[model samples]
Target: MPDLPPIVDLRQSPTALRVQRGVMRFLRAAHGFSCFAEVSLANGRRADVLGIGPKGEIWIVEIKSSLTDYQVDRKWPEYKEFCDRFFFAKPPELDPDIFPPEEGLMVGDGHDAAILRMAPDGPLPPARRRAMLLKLARLGADRVHTLMDPGEPL
Candidate 1:
């Protein structure tokens, strides 16, 4: 078996910090977005950085210091339901093929950040898209477990 790469703790690694800085800079320059670091979602899931794109598209970025951390989290599916775009950030050495080819955005360079949008092709109905956007807006504005308790709106 091929030897697995050693995982590094992001909280303590300079490379992880640089990747984070690159992600922040990329978001700022590409989308004029304000990165909400470690924002708690209604489901008690915290995203590394949530950015609102210029077109009102919601982006959820999950940053991992190591490939192993990314593999173990397994929460990207939940994030997809909440945001229009879902991204995974880590060092470039991590293979993007590890992510689901149809549903994940890979973001990072060994020294900077790069992103690939993996949204499916074809257009959603305007009404459905608008409704989803509204839900995202509400979720971003306040915290409520609408996703959990379907009867409640926050």
Candidate 2:
């Protein structure tokens, strides 16, 4: 096998550090409304941030430094199964619309930070939605292993 490049530490890059700090600050502000950060899903997928609104709406926020990161990842669809609302966080220059139209909300910075809610023109059937939600709930509750363990009969 060929050698791979070493991982670059964002801490050493001023630009990356600034963006990281911005994301942290945004998450902190969200915490005031009962939102929290770094919530882990049962499948080992850690959402960058998660928050529940007073009315019980679940929000999932995924942060990216650039549009390319948003485009290449496959996890966003999986994230949709878990939350009623979803958001992508990036700098003001990045256009959130680059993502699929049906996926989720787009939150960008301008003035003091603003959000645009993107609705899926065609939604999944209610039954399918419920199934996905249940799967995600189990994952979040750390019960996925029970379902996946080979020792247990299906």
Candidate 3:
């Protein structure tokens, strides 16, 4: 048998992981979006949850595990430049009103989430949308290829 390279182990805080799961469940089960976690936007900021809908609309969700988490993350606003809609997903215990009124709200547990309000659409420019969709396709293909061939070079 040939020797194989070690697999990378991505770690996340338990709280963050739970929130991610909840956000993903909500995006998939409720919104019919295909989601990817920890996706890097062209601006170099990472989105906690990036969802692509059937009609090519892009949504970015910033997950806040605690009050402090929400307070300290100032870069979430920049995510709007890259996506059509933006939202904040947090534990059900947090008050949805605490977030910005113009943005969307989602309350989630470890398994699911409920949308308290709908996000307003801010459609992306055609060029940016095309670029983003290409990036997403490449990322998806890379992930699938890696799973199929563990030693494949990215």
The prediction achieving the highest lDDT against the true structure is 3
Segments in model 2 whose C-alpha atoms lie over 4 Å from true places? 1-32, 109-111, 118-154
lDDT of 1 by residue, 2-30 (tens): 22221222343665566667787788787
TM-score list, all predictions: 0.63, 0.54, 0.87
The lDDT values for all models are 0.62, 0.53, 0.81
Question: In candidate 1, where is summed lDDT lowest over 10 consecutive residues?
Answer: 1-10
Pitting candidate 1 against candidate 3, the one with the higher TM-score is 3
Q: Tally clashes: model 2.
A: 1
lDDT of 3 by residue, 35-154 (tens): 888887889888888999989999998888778878887888889988999988888776676789999988777898878777899999999999999999998877666667876554
TM-score of 2: 0.54
C-alpha RMSD (angstroms) for model 2: 9.5
Q: How accurate is candidate 2 locally (lDDT)?
A: 0.53
